[model samples]
Structures are given as structure tokens and as C-alpha cells.
Target: MKKVFSQIISLVMAVLVLASTVSWTVDKHLCMGRVMDISFFAHAEDCGMESAIATLDSEDYQNPCCEDESFTIEGQDHLKLTWSDLDLDHQVFLVAFAQSYIDLFVPLEKLPVPNEKYPPPILIRDIHVLDQVFLI
Candidate 1:
């Protein structure tokens, strides 16, 4: 009885370990900034291969972000990037992950005062921010 109980516990533990180690696959097709199709898969090789082979290629998709212009940043220096330079996948990746790069020399504006009722206590205009002033 003791040995049988131990075997049952070991089988249950093995099954739990196997279940925890299973991998899942997610398939998504996006067009025009929208998800057109989505699918879930337990087996990598069996996900879409069988279905795709069974069907004929009949879909033609166009990217909505495609525009005829050189998107450039100007101020500190001239930076130019054209649609031809980056592919659809890379452009999408850049839009999703890359940070917006603003030109450093683009005219910096002072923050607006929150309360207009009171005048600014100190006028910091045209002063070197790093200079230290000593009060006598």
C-alpha cells in the first residue's frame, strides 16, 4: 500500500511538470493598424502549415503607413529617412519601439506660469543657468 501510494504521487508530479513545460504559439496578422486575423497554437510545426497548404494564396495586404515622402528631422542637423530605406516590418518595429528623436537646437520654450494672478518672483531670462550668485 505504501509503495503504491508513492508511485501515484510520483506520476502526478511528473504530469504536472510536463504540463508546466508546454509552450504555446500566438499568430497575428495586422493590416492598416488593425489586427485582421489571430490564432493560437500548441504545436509549433502544426500551427499553420497544414491549413496554409490546404488553402490557396489569395490575400494581398498593403501597409497604411506607406506614404511618398522623406520623413526628416531638422534643427541641430538635417536627418533624413525615406520609405525606401526601411521595409514594412522594420518601419513597424521602429514605430513600436524607437523613441522620438527631437532636434536639440529646436528653440526651447519656457514653461508657462500656472498662476497668472501673481507675477514671477524672479526673472531668469537671459541668465546663464550654471552661474552662481552670492547674496551679500
Candidate 2:
């Protein structure tokens, strides 16, 4: 009876520990939220080949044809993308593979100025940005 009781207690403790660990991992691994407003006008980013070579989160979301994938950004600080994420550390840049592209980074003059008239926002299919690793 004593041996069985001890085994049961040990098993319970182990289960609790595992459960807690899993809970923590799930909480920390993904950013969970909802699109609260239609005014949430922002850029949608997709992970390219470079991302695939590095991690799995993108694989979870990106299609096999590498078509348009759903990548969401939470707030302005956290950008959730369809890419490996490099263990959730490398922040990826959304780049579109296109032809006849000359520049990836736009100049300041092209950006909307305080008093200057500007045309509609450009839909750049080919974006180029390097992943930035964060210290967690």
C-alpha cells in the first residue's frame, strides 16, 4: 500500500510539472490575439526561402507553392510572420520575389512628408530585409 501510494504521488507530481512546462511553452512560443479593428491597416509580411532554411513556424503557415501566406503583426512592436522565426528570436523582413526591381529600401523623399502630396501606397511584391535577432 505504501509503495503504491508513493508511486501515485510521484506520477501526479510528474504530470503537473509536464503540464506546467507545456503551458509555459505554448504561452511564450506564440503571440495570441485577435484583429480588434478594421482600421488595423498595416502591412502583411510573408516568409521567403531564407526563412524556410532557418526555422519551422513559417512552415506551419506558409504554403508549399510559397503563395500568399497569412502573416499578422501584433501591435507595432511585435511582427508575427510566416517563417522559421529562428527559435522565435530572428525577426524577419518581408520580401516579395519580383522582377525589374532596382531598390529594396526606399528613400526618405519617397515617404509621405508632412506637407507634400503623395500618391497611393505602393504594393511592393519584392521586399528585402535581414532578420534581426533579439536578446530574449
Candidate 3:
């Protein structure tokens, strides 16, 4: 369960990074203060009001009622970072962290076997039987 949870967390983080690095744009066409069309990958369709306004008068042409607006979401352009980009303190901390992480997995030296030099005492009789120790 712990392993699965970690994998899911890692996947979410990867997706978050990918989403933050992606860029997109939203194009919207408004006619008379009302949205006419909205598009993401293509240009928004106009309401054909600009052509009608232009044909009304040749010399005196006012601004058309329809407007095209675009909203751009810019993502990170510099995603590639090198080790040298880190400051001196950060580099030291990273090195120390890596060293400690590696050390955590290192097999510890085997402890000395307990009582390895001691010899077992010889028993001629059963101590519990000789002592008349009985449990009800």
C-alpha cells in the first residue's frame, strides 16, 4: 500500500510539472457584448458585423460592434536546469542529503554475537524437579 501510494504521488507530481510547462491560448469572439464563439486551437468565428459596418459607409466608418479577444497562458520557457545553477549552500545541502540517503541503505556491521565466549553450565539434575516448584 505504501509503495502504491508513493507511485501515485509521483505520477501526480509528474503531471503537475507537465501541466505547468505547457502553454495554451483561448480565443473569444464577442458581438454586441455577447460571446459569439470561443476556440482554443483555432481562431474564433466572427459575427459578420464588421463586413456590414464597412459596407454601410466608405468614408465614415465607425468601429465594428464585434470584437475578438485572446487570452494567452505562457508556460515556463527554461525548464532545463543544470547542477551548476544551484547556489553554494544548496549544492552543499544536496550533497549532504544524497550522502545521507545512500548511507541509510548501507548494511550495518553485524553486532557481536551475545554471550559467544560463555560456556553452558553442566546440569546433573532437573532444577525445577529438584526444587519442588509446582504450578497449579
What total of clashing residue pairs does each candidate reach? Answer: 0, 6, 0
How many pairs of residues in model 2 come into backbone collision?
Answer: 6
- Rate residue 91 of model 3 by lDDT: 97
Clashing pairs in 2: 55-84, 58-83, 95-127, 96-125, 96-126, 96-127
**Backbone clash tally (model 1):** 0
The residue-by-residue lDDT of candidate 2 on 1-136, one tens digit each, is 9999999999999887565544121111111233222222343343344466457654546434333323333323344545665443333223323322436554566656675666777856533333454557
Q: Which candidate is the best by TM-score?
A: 3
| Candidates sorted on TM-score, descending | 3, 1, 2
lDDT of 1 by residue, 8-56 (tens): 9999998876655555455555434445455555211223433554475
**Candidate 2, run of 10 with poorest lDDT:** 23-32
Better of 1 and 2 by lDDT: 1
**Model 3 C-alpha RMSD to native:** 5.0
Ranking by lDDT: 3, 1, 2
- What's the TM-score of each model vs. the native? 0.21, 0.19, 0.62
